[model samples]
Target: MSWEKSVRRVTPYVPGEQPKDKNIIKLNTNECPYPPAPKVRELISGLRYEDMRLYPDPEASSLIKALSGYYNVPEDQIFVGVGSDDVLSMAYLTFFNSDNPILFPDITYSFYDVWAELYKVPYKKIPLRDDFTIDFTEYYGDKQPNGGIIIANPNAPVGIYEPVSKIEDVVAHNPDSVCIIDEAYIDFGGESALPLIKKYDNVLIVQTFSKSRAMAGMRIGYAFGSKKLIKYMQDAKFSFNSYTMNRPSLELGIAAIEDDVYFKETCNKIIATRERVKKELSALGFTFPDSKANFIFAKHDKLTGEELFLALKNAGIYVRHWNADRIYDYLRITIGTDEEMDKLISFLQKYL
Candidate 1:
């Protein structure tokens, strides 16, 4: 069967590989090395199999209320999805139109580009500065109007964060268009854009349990914005899949959100680990952006990113490698448990 021309043109986003070996020190995906709060496990264990007969709360009300209280936003202003990726896709459908072109940093979460392609929306990629930082002046400060804007706060692959104040300045100025801040990795470091949502009706902040919350397996994510904007996203979600979040995920998400202490403690640990990794890499003559996220983007003059990635893989260590322009030599390595990181460093020391 033939697909629609738009579907045919789309190239789906490639997630990090989940290798079969359990012994491998997996650092390719930016997943939390620690287990989610023990409450999540308890919650999951308590779930009855018979509950599967009924659909999950179509709106995930409990989780929404929990998030509302957590973010200090009203329930009407929050919407949860299978993952932040779902919320992002819904944003593309609900806010972006074919008439107005979408704009985002060229070196950002790859899924943003995929969404643009999937929706057949016109988009222009504003290149990052030579120093690998987002140049908001070139994007929003210019007179040109865009259909919508999406940016990863601490952008992926590069692992550099844009200040929340700078983001506020840009969103404050762009009142006419939808501005989406994908904060999937923000909890690790960097300020959340949730505060700006109260001030800007056009701004939408998407977050996920996959990263900081250690709920990637639960496939839960959410978006915070004005009630009106959130309603539109809800409409989009219902139009596509009313019961987008499953029962187990919904319950686990609630438990995860409620367990703030575990989340904060784990995040702090990851932050410390990230700094240690950064210092070690820098000492080895490797250059990397000062990462605020749980990962580091490091590259050495003596070896290519691909070479290091392959070498690490051969040594039972996994990390992410992208061949994009100006970043081809860098490897994105996730901060894992202290023991896991030590193993990775040992492998690098031996191989490099």
Candidate 2:
């Protein structure tokens, strides 16, 4: 209460719980269940401790070059940040300056509203359809001015992936406003809108190494856009903090990108496991959306989400549950390894 009135006094976003015990099977955060590519470990262990004395690359040149080559985008079009959260926050601060409200789905990433409030940006939530799918047309028609648009493809909590064609429709209609696709979970199953960057100058695609690359602990995230948009976000970033990247992250991130075979194999494994678990949970009388991401959002026929969430927590199996309206009965479960999932399923068998 003693802080300045203008200081950030808004309610903050609460991330999934991180328990102290290592015995817990954490299925709440939607992080990659497997380890990062072996090269990451090899590279990090060999990295000289003496290099920490010097500041890391301000522009994150090596990693950007690797990403540019992998995604076939130009190096100049890439923007690297602490995490996708940082990149999105910078994007919100930089691109959404108009007095008009930004647009996002009502039940998408919980952090969207927190960032909007922290930056004092105006934003409006468009309702998801009855099945929790995005209606691409809801963003069109010019009835109201939108400052910008952002959506999580394979949206968080719901785990429903919108097709690329639908994404194109939204970006095409908002030619003047920045349209950002938060593709944090795209690597699992959804088609990427990265190709649209070549055609639409106003589009931005943000992704993370935290999910697919299993580097959540490393905190690396990046974005790609037209040269103009990238340049503006870069300017905003440098102004905020020039050396946002550190020595270990800049080096290890490049290692993660170089191991393409391992990356795809890990994603494929998670996808396979997700499909199998979906069938098992369904057999247990749970109903969920058709998930294309590395997680499933489900509600049991006889159990409230809160009840099941507590039951799993006591059993040392963690998954996410929200108290928010429309989703209070749902639990968002991250797809972990086969063994971990077996444990989860066995624990849930008692509910039947």
Candidate 3:
């Protein structure tokens, strides 16, 4: 009991439900319905089991080189982690140490607040406009005076993509703090704020192989920042754990990056599916923000979000729904294969 009193405690983030049944259509967690690049399959079978006995490259140099060549950023500016969550947690720990509160959208990624609370970082959640879009002017640190900022472009659940110009404005205004842009879904259809990294020394742009590369299982996430910013993050990470990236992840992540053609094709397919499904959902009396990501956040004109979520679940379909304020009426449905989306539409048609 004495030790328990000193233990750090905070409510953890609740992820989308991962049901056990394999036969059901799964569109809950915003994962790519498609398989990873064909090369990834080839690489997995060829990997030496003996390699696992040795520790992976602590710097993850090979993977970093691959990413550097692909993204055209210098290797020194790059940092890799187990996942974007890991990368973000490290950034929060390394940068948001100020007594003043960090800032993020109230309706943005749920993990931001959890990380803030877990690390004892004071934070302010600025409310998104009624249309579920961020008011960039509100993010002007000159007015709000915060220690740091993190934003999820093509914001999750809502799936609205703010323009790079708007993102740039936030970064420009907040020169005193580290501004992080979480672009996990940027490959889907959104323009990235990555260019701003060159313009602002204080900016860190984070991305993941999980969503677009179909390697969420591999848990590869990386960031690009000024060399100084990245080095500081590396010092913090190495101090915490040098071997955050394992052998399989490093090798497979490079394989995923090298298959440029396959990667683009997969993203295009998801985008096409998303646009078609948008039209279909609209016809079905559902309305949602224009989604640039691989998911649609929808609410039916006649039915509640939970009603549809339960009905679909009972029919062996899974889509995400939240009981929280403002978005309680919405369902965040990951864009699956065309057949899966058709099945979803067919079920909704019959049920309605």
Candidate 4:
């Protein structure tokens, strides 16, 4: 009982279900249906087993170099972690130390609240508008002198994207606090807030390889910020774990970012599929927000989200569904390949 009292207790974030069967149609988690860049595959196959014995670079210089070359940012202004989740968690620990509650959307990424609670940091959930768009005025910090701001550009689950100009308005208003724009799905269609990083020292723009680069398995995510802001994150990361990134991830990440053409082609394919699926879903009497990410958040007119979710699951299809209030009737479906999308469309036609 004494040890139990001292143990940390908080509800952890539940990720989308990962089914083992290869036969199932998985559109639940927003993973790229295609394989990683060809160069990444070559690097993986060619990596030597003997190199595993040695510790990886604490600085992750090689991956940072590749990112710098790709994004045209200086090495001192970039920070890499195992994934965006790791990067965000470290940032929450590093920057959100003030007593005022941090601000985020009520229906944004579920991880934001989880991290806030885990760190015992105060936070306030500013509700999104009726149509699921962020009201930038609420985040101005004029009425509420808050600690920090972490916004998922094109906020997740809802799949609606806000413009970078609006994001800049928030950043400019909250000059005293750090402003983090979690751009995990930005590669799909949304404009990035990266340019703001150059103009505002408080802005930190985070992106990941999981969605567009098709390397979710490799777990490479990075952030761009001013030199001083990046140094704070790096210091916090090294203090926590000097070797957060391993050798294979570092080498493979370099290969992923190098092939620019393949990455763009892959994103284009997904965007095309998503648009087509949107029309088909509309014809079947489903309404959803205008999604800019690789997924659609949809609700059917005739059936509850649970009913459709269970039906699809029984038929070996998987899409994300949540029982939370406001979004309880919606489904978040990731865009798969043309063939895979066809299978999903066919299933809906017969089921409806």
The C-alpha stretches of model 1 lying farther than 4 A from their native spots are 1-7
User: How far out, in Å, is residue 262 in model 3?
Assistant: 0.5
Q: Which of the two candidates, 1 or 2, achieves a greater TM-score against the reference? A: 2
| Global CA lDDT computed for model 1 | 0.88
Candidate 1 on 1-352: residue-level lDDT in tens?
A: 4556534566889989999989998999999999999899888879999989999899899999999898888899998998998889999999999486788988888888888888888999999888889878765735657888888988987889888898988887678889999999898888887889878899999999999999899899899999899989888888898988999988888888888899999999999998888887777788988888989988899999899989999888999998788889989999999999888887788777
User: Which model is ahead, 2 or 4, in terms of TM-score?
Assistant: 4
For 98-175, candidate 4 gives per-residue lDDT tens digits of 999999999989999999999999999999998999988999878768999999987898889889889999999999
- Tens digits of per-residue lDDT, candidate 2, 139-195, equal 973855799999999899798999899999999889889999999999999899999
Ten residues in sequence with the least summed lDDT for candidate 4? 135-144
Error of 2 at 306 (Å): 0.4
Q: For every model shown, what is its TM-score relative to the native structure?
A: 0.97, 0.98, 0.99, 0.99
Give the poorly placed runs of model 2, Cα more than 4 Å off.
1-3
The per-model lDDT (C-alpha) reads: 0.88, 0.93, 0.94, 0.93
Name the top lDDT candidate: 3
Cα lDDT of candidate 3 equals 0.94
Model 4 TM-score is 0.99
* Regions more than 4 Å wrong, model 4: none
